[model samples]
Target: MEQIWDNNDWLESANHWVTKQLKLQKINSIGRLKPVSGWGLGHVLKQPTEQGDVYFKATAKLPLFSNEALLSRYLHSINMPTPEVLAIEETHQYQLTKDFGGGLAEDSSATLWADAFEQFAQLQLDSLSYLKDFNKQGCLNRPISDVAAQLQLLIEHPQLQSLLDSEIILATEKAIAKLSHNIDELSQLEIGETLVHGDLHIENVAMSDDQCIFFDWSDACISHPFIDGTYLYRMPDSQDKTQIIDAYLKPWKQHYQPQQVEQAWQLCEHVCYAHQAISYASMMLHLSPEARVELNTAFQNALSASLRSNRQTVKSTTCVRSKFCGMVSGILHTLSLIQIKAGEAL
Candidate 1:
């Protein structure tokens, strides 16, 4: 099936609208729009102007992604360092923004990482006041208490179950009871729900004027802020990782004791992966079967990680030595375990 951007009529319409919008900004387009990247979910086009290059992104018409344009604007209005939205067509899930320079580089220094973490931590801290705005913008609202039901739904999802072994399915079903306990314990700590960059990573952050500018709000949601730490725990450098983690936790320290912050962070390890599984599974529901196949491995791996992390947490009350456990690399090792147990059932 052709993607929405592949339709000539739609492309022409977008181009015309962009040209008119640029004229309103008194910026002249120096060239035609160039396709940057595209997929079933959305497409990005680059348009060069006399002032600078601006980007146009259009997302699939699903509630999950439709809030990106408006949400991004709202974030900027609330003093978050997001890219400037040149124009937005919320009805169509289309947005245009001036380029914010290149994203955080692969070889960024530990200092930059620490700085980014500190800034983003404060961003999440400040986002609490605007929960109503975020909800009004249709952001996904996945509170911790609701995650158990999300897991139960995934256990009953026929399409997801079809791709899984009986043992894997049973493991997910078994994970719910223990996971629910962890969720309740963590909720008692009152860490507070805030904005979560559901797909956060260094690449999604742009460094502008030495400031960490976060963009790409397609997967933005409201949830426990620490769940946003999914990538920080996976960083390759232990020393730098510690620094980054400290910088992030420093902001939260003002609201809770060090013990509470540490405990919630540990508990969030498993819950974060569960959230990832639910997110991927939810996206799959909106995709075509062909597109859904593209995400099957990711969905399965996230689910597998969630269950594995929960069991690991159960085995030891203390924090696990390897923070990387149940992350991408750990998922590879667990895949082998899954194959070995595939024939067995609960």
Candidate 2:
């Protein structure tokens, strides 16, 4: 059978696949297969069962899904709170995993955030030994050189030039040049790296009893441990930010000097922002023209904000540039494909 694309098609396939994989006689009371957010290359189905709920994720991008499965198994073996992988259909490019209930509450208390951060710190500390394994699994290795290259590509992209005003573009280029020096400074730091949950927002976390379980490992990478904190700092309210950082840093205090940890944290935040902007730009190619324009504007705005911040930080000694610029080259290359498609349509 051909791979499914739409949710309706996946639902039809899942009825048979789930029955065969789980050995269920019939799918009794299957809940609505709603689309999950935050994934561009795949779709997730929340399949309910008498026993419990299981999630079925189908992706055309096999490597990302396969990596998630591999990382989940590794984390499970290490006693981290990752969902169980139930089945893998290599041919269809789908996988089933045991779901961990609803996500963390929107108005979650400070206590819950504290517990989550503590667990997050412990996960980073525990996974240090498996850095080599993570790299072998095709997780991104974001070195300073790679990051500088990505920024350079973005600065030169034709689409980027057309998107921003000439003056703004010139300012951005100057900021990137200055930021390059700061990136070099970061390359000299003696920081240890581990598996970074590239996207670590509260929506990706679930609270089970007293334990905080994390899901959605598609963006996992091998980078500085503090890379995960990039999203954490952005998710909390301004008043709660200090507490969240303190909780996350409490466990690492024994392993790293306060200044070293703080430096890593700052660098990782900018890296994460740049990475996110690049990802959004890349995703624009897959969207409809109307959707593409909307997202393009958003990406442009975000890029402007990042450039402005970079300009300010470029004057400071603590400025650290991220290697997300490497991804920007690929995104820029896709502009030709988009142009070709547009010509064909005309």
Candidate 3:
């Protein structure tokens, strides 16, 4: 069988990206770029120069770069639980980042772990206090068109045909467009906006010895606090997820409405998997069968759960009922901080 990975190109691309994006010369073989399992675009490179541990992630085609950058800047400015954004360059097809990594996600004490999440949750809540306005700073992206393109690509590609459903597929396109229009309507209601870590899944976060610092600012943005909470809902472990939320919401549930928080979780339930589905399909197109089957199954389950949960999100304000009934199972929660690299879209 033909191997899908190009051993030579991975390292070559990393070096080129570092040179162009960081403008740092003298980056030696250091090590090779290893693609992070499950994620299609994130490439982790081991650097020999910086103690055989420091790594670089070159992410291209991330969806929410500007928003992520803005949010990371906001968090960093306020002293939040995010990674230091080393460098970023927003060209056409991708954005490159040099992340300051120290330890793995599983290596942290309970007190320290809680503190990290608490710090991050506090940062998000603080930002939400008087948050309002979007950065007319650069080109405004069209979410509908962008998501539609992804769906279209999958439909057109033979390799990813398994996941497509004609009726559901078409409905998803219209739903994405509707969501875009709803986003426009958000400002009309004078909804307060806070810095959001557009995509805050657990894998994107890493814990160092002294802190629980998070990386991946591609999804950073100024949006409803609910959106930020929803972003936090992606952690796979149920107990861990609650702990993260409780720590974040501890100091300030009074400042937020519970219903709104529920809304946020439901929204994330739908959109996060929406992202995963697209991501999974893209990976299936290029990955070996083993990788494809695992990701595809996960995507399928997520899509089903999201669809079931989002069904009740249509103006039912009592409690944010989601298909993933656990998030809103009457557990008040809180969160810590996130990071933003230059121009790397989430």
Candidate 4:
């Protein structure tokens, strides 16, 4: 964690790596050292240009480095939104990416990210055939099970275990079970080969005017067709979410099985929930006092959301008769409608 070499020194070291991958000039003084997160080896630099603006990213030995680059190339070829990897290669102690920009960050608006979501959906249809070749659906999803194991580890961390009381842990476990059940449901859906973005999320998606760019191909692999909607399915609002999914599925289903598409949403949501839990643990295990409070607050919000959703799902499965009962029932039913709108099953 000590400074990964001085920023400028790191820049030069990175440029040599880039030169091996593609032709690019080394410029003096980075336009700005953008603060970014995830996999910590990467950094962004902007260089002002007469024609337009150019951005660069430097990394130290990315795991599966070439595979990520190849996937990025494939994605770009399909006209999906993604940073152009002008070049990439290894240097003395690091790897480098030239002009890598795009992908959302820690602080971004989910409401206004519709365009990004749409682009991702479009790309899913285009890329599904090839996605499965990169990673198998069953194995990529084992991480979902890992999430439960991670949560169980926290039984020793009193600060975290305290959150499990008051139906939180029980509810969490139930949802996870449903997730596993749904994952099995997907395997049985009879859907054919397709590529999937194993870890699509708001932060992994980015927007630029009418274009939406997806980055971070670390988890890019082959999966069941519908597994890509993991982020949009968990997002807020039924009305917009429905319109959004219809925008992607209604027409496309004529080509692929609608049920398969639907099953993808179900599997994606649970896997995504598991992924979030893992991400939370990764952040909290060594967070500062302030960061710890924020992490706990976030986990609580997700917990509350999950509980409210299950209650509504149960109410939707029951009968409704009276006006007052109907009213509460309608509200819960509305919340339960999230899965339906996002293209998941009841």
Candidate 1, 81-149: lDDT as tens digits: 889888988876788999988578757887887888889988898888888878887587878888889
By TM-score, who's the top model here? 1
lDDT of each model, Cα atoms only? Answer: 0.81, 0.65, 0.50, 0.51
Better candidate number, 2 or 3, judged by lDDT = 2
If ranked by TM-score, best first, what sequence of candidates would result?
1, 2, 4, 3
Give the winner by lDDT.
Answer: 1
| TM-scores of the candidates in the order shown | 0.87, 0.76, 0.55, 0.59
Q: How far is 97's C-alpha from truth in model 1 (Å)?
A: 0.3
Error of 4 at 29 (Å): 8.0
TM-score of 2: 0.76
Give the alpha carbon lDDT tens digit for every residue of 11-99 in model 3: 66556665554436434434444544324434455444442333455443433345344444445555567665544443322333345
Instruction: Measure candidate 4: CA RMSD.
Output: 10.0
User: For residues 33-99, what per-residue lDDT tens digits would candidate 2 score against the true structure?
Assistant: 4556324455687767776777777653432223565556567766778776777675555667777
Indicate whether candidate 1 or candidate 4 has the larger TM-score: 1
Model 4 error, position 265 (Å): 3.6
| lDDT (Cα, 0-100) at 316 in candidate 3 | 42
